[model samples]
Target: MSHASPAPAGITRRQALSAGAALCAGAPASAARRKPNLLFIHTDQHFAGAIAAHGCADVHTPNIDRLIARGVTFHESYSANPVCCPARTAWYTGRCTSESGVVQNDRFPIEPAMPDLGQWFGARGYDALYAGKWHVTGRDFTPSFRVLSHGHGLGEHGDATVARAAREYLRSRRRTDKPFFLSLGFLQPHDICYWVFAHTEPLAALPYPDLARELPPLWPNHGFDAREPETFRKNWRMGRIRQNMERWEEWQWRYYRWSYYRHVEMVDAHIGTVLDALAESGHDRDTAIIFTADHGDGMGAHQLWQKMYFYEEAARVPFVVSWPGELEAGKQDRAHLVSGLDVAPTLCDLAGIEAPPDCRGRSLAPLLRRKPVEWRDYLVSEAATTGRMVRTAGHKFIKYQGDGTEQLFDMRADRGEMHNLAAEGSSAGVAADHRKLLKEWEAHLSPSPAGRLTGTWDG
Candidate 1:
């Protein structure tokens, strides 16, 4: 749990002192006793296991590792709705995808009545500022935070530009009069989608050298599962049938994996830049930083290419919360199931502000303080309207709405999710229990519009 890493090389004494003074300046004596500043750093399509500190051996993420070492890491964190807009909406609104009415990507706008994270914090006198990707709705961000960046367009050097904007904000403009809630959203590994699209040509046709030895190995569960739900199978088949990427050999897949990790590393470097700025600004100790992703990418798992699936590689995300002296450090919480839905409520609770009335998530502030607290018995995640998953201590159950195809895995034994226990007669009772849990969860969801439920599966 010790964050004992060496300081990143090349930082100057003057830069550090100036940044620190800026953070501590102009604070009213009363404001000194107020809430800690909140820094929420979000990434797009970053797999939970891709970080070195999180058990992946193939990728290097020194920055992420340092952050993890300084905080409690949530090993079981998941995206409640594993798509871009839906998952992000859950993070901002503290509501499930169905409740937020954004069940898929680029389709549903958050209803005007619901208060987003920025509005909620801004109402409490925090200067809520947002930078980087804001895909929850259309271009107008006036109702949210004080918008710091515009559009989804990548800047020069991509994520580095986003980090530069954030660093500049911290260094030059951050207000010391009140606690600030800054959300930095970086887009990187999501670029792997463009990579896939632009690299449809055969590897032989490209000019790259053989990299078999340096490439990542295929996932143990790389082969297709016969018992995968028909809806998922159809989606996967359509992707392959359209792109013909199924013709890629093992080495090619390995190369793709290698490239994905490089993108992750690229984003990690930008993250380091922002973190360094925070430390230099002197707010490192007084700021609560929550690091997580909107969702995850498949990273060649199950021979899949992108997200929108309930698979672990796509649904689970890296979640870490660090506030130097206030929260426990260097700890990993593997006992409870956590989700993107918990972020807003947890931040509000830590800041002593009230979350919106319709927020569904429970606060993790008690747990972060190492206090005994009651927790939910099961965790639920949605995939558009086609799939709903329920995960408990020992098992994971996935059901598809269209054909009633079910997948049940004994997570304790088959963490790879290779075996299908739902079809087996002996495991029927466990599946039934999970079914009941899913039903109870569904009962709480507000009804989706007829069009939203029947839209094309565009993943």
Candidate 2:
């Protein structure tokens, strides 16, 4: 069988501009300035306390912790969604999952029509570069980057591939005077080390730090909550679901935690490799570096092992922004609620390009200066499945469609999400407020002329 040849390429700047304007009908014009180079470093399945600087002694993440020390780390930053592709799409596009339709893995490619961050930067004469996972789309779709090195397969040395490509780009940047945008996506912890290294070595043989592993406070103690939803059971991939720890061996939990830390350490090493290249190429000060993750791993929090929920363990991500003089060094911003969706406009602001007005996120540039920016007080997040969450300064509310069960917690008092305050009589107003916020948030993500719903998660 013969395949039809693709149409010829004749897309002019005028046509491209028209297409862009159509998508972002009221977006602002590009500002003229010297564009700063961007080095966006991202990882997969990274939890909030994964870094040693964040107080997780179980793993050694010296390089990442170093970045935190030299940059502004948003202590309470989180992903708009806690799944893989959806979260990543949100991060790059500055929009929610519903806007991009990348709510789950393999749902669909990121909307080609959208004005992506890289594409926006590239339009302003910055050389855009992409390396690593590229899980947002298959090879069929092309990114705005001038150079793309997408390593195929679930390669053993995926991080190495990313490091090598980033190093090369830095070396090339040394020779060129053109400003550039580099997106380095690393796939480490998501590699599933437990299944990869399970049988060959006993879980005990795996190297792990001697520090005690404290469990999250929200989950019911072992041998309780056997009535967890079937969706949670199926997604956890557990051999069996029981109310408590009696059915499962202690080795299971130990293995899970150890592998999670190990993978994080492995990626940290690769990050160091990239940082070394930057210093060697003398772009350390010139390039504004940002480190973040797509989403987080559950790691047995709430007795769940994977993401797709609104629990803190799954939703929150480590967010670090490093700019030597422009951004406050070693400062931690705790009051503001930032989202992965904010990444796009922030990157655009750094590159001196006008961010698409339709982009649902606002720039963090003002916040970086320690100025009071009216940031979103309530950040909304959604799952691949039918779940919606609203996070306020002191509370989080989740409504699971399968059962209409609501999860309410006062995050300020109960960071672990332990006590469900939804049923209590005293917290009725809080619950109602969160519900209204959830509706407003959902309306923004699901904008249409009428009120059509986007596709839902199969779970």
Candidate 3:
């Protein structure tokens, strides 16, 4: 017996047109009438509470707010991992970070051959346009978009060039016969750059609020621990001294809040440009717009400046999905668990195409229409080394590798994750449930490659 032939190596214009024709014909009348276009706008290091609509009275993001007003705003949307490369790859492939073997920044590159969501969309007749930060490959590789325009200066914190290029892509896409998938990637808020002290720029000149920036309620300090490890204690002492000396412990807090808000404002401004162009092209109503971030920055929260932790500031991200008439406006989804991985599959499903069998995420179409489905009861997250986090409606359980370091918090009572119930509680059953989830997750962890190349790659 012979199997069906595989798809072409890369999505060609011919394949796109043929797929478009097939999709238009075989699809139901409503599906063929006007398939929703996808405007996937994402940023780096943005938190859930950073937006005004999400009870953040300070930061102003009107474009994002408009998207929320038109579609569902997932209050509890989270990243599978809170790091940069791994999280992005997971978002692209709809696979767990462990499966991708990209658990940290040092993992460097994700294989180009990895079946990515953009390629899937391109194969299905959606015109995928990628602009701004393209961190997926260690080097350049093929993107699903027919036109791959880059190196137009999408670098740094205060650059306006990338935003301009994104606007151009939107304007240029007006005449396409197919719906579009435009990815507007922004590099903001994530520019803490403090990890490399030598290369770090001063936080001077950035606008800061007058009020003292309150640290994350759950910020872990050495003094808070009864019996901290010697290594952790040493690091903590040094970190505190550096923070105190640089006044980074003080001024940087305000600076971070300032820069983060400004970056968000910058992203929103570009979004407005695109929105105006869409309106001009008469495609605003026909398009489905989604706004989210790859991951979040700690932004000095928990005494940590970046992600790779299970804290709310780093783990949770803002997610907004909008389509004018098909979706209910101004609605918030608090019950369903949405992951960054869900994006690609959801877009494919929305376009009336079957997501490849290997894709790990489910469609959010039902949730978008306010229809009921059996949403996940426990959402999982991963980070550096081997860490597992399970978040339910009211609690968050975290287990770090063999150190036996575990954390549990009643999210409803301690939204700040201030209290750790693992040390004190009669909830052995809850703890057991968390352990069961961990065991199941552990079963899924991909085995690390063995042998000589490990040492050289550990950088």
Q: Please list the Cα RMSD from the true structure of every candidate, rounded to 1 decimal place.
A: 10.1, 8.5, 7.7
Write the residue-wise lDDT of candidate 3 on 1-459 in tens digits: 001211111122343244333323433247547667888777788888788788776678897787787788898888877877777777777666655556667454555456676787787777777766656635342445544445332235433555666667667765557878777777665554443243134545434344445422322321132333233234333464345534443455555555567667767776777777777777888888878887877555544456666778888998888888777899998877777767765777667777554444456676776444445566677765436677878788877643556678788887876667876668667877877765554543342331112211112
lDDT of 1 by residue, 37-148 (tens): 9999998999898899998899999999999999989988888778888888888888776666777777777776778889889989898988888788532556678877
- Model 2 misplaced regions, further than 4 Å: 1-33, 138-143, 152-155, 193-246, 447-459
Q: Candidate 1 or 3, higher lDDT?
A: 1
Listed in order, each prediction's TM-score against the native is 0.89, 0.82, 0.80
Query: How many angstroms is residue 413 displaced in model 1 relative to the true structure, after the best TM-score fit?
Result: 0.9
Q: How does each model score on lDDT?
A: 0.76, 0.68, 0.63
TM-score-better candidate, 1 vs 3: 1
lDDT of 2 by residue, 305-379 (tens): 567787777788999989776678898888877778778867776666677646665566767765443446677
Candidate 2 clashing pairs?
Answer: 223-244, 224-243
Output the worst ten-in-a-row residue range by lDDT, candidate 1. 1-10
List the candidate numbers ranked by lDDT, top first: 1, 2, 3
User: After aligning candidate 1 to the native by TM-score, how far in Å is the CA of 433 from where it should be?
Assistant: 0.4
Cα-lDDT of candidate 2: 0.68
Please identify model 1 stretches exceeding 4 Å from their true place: 1-32, 173-175, 240-243, 448-459
Give the number of the best model, judged by lDDT.
Answer: 1
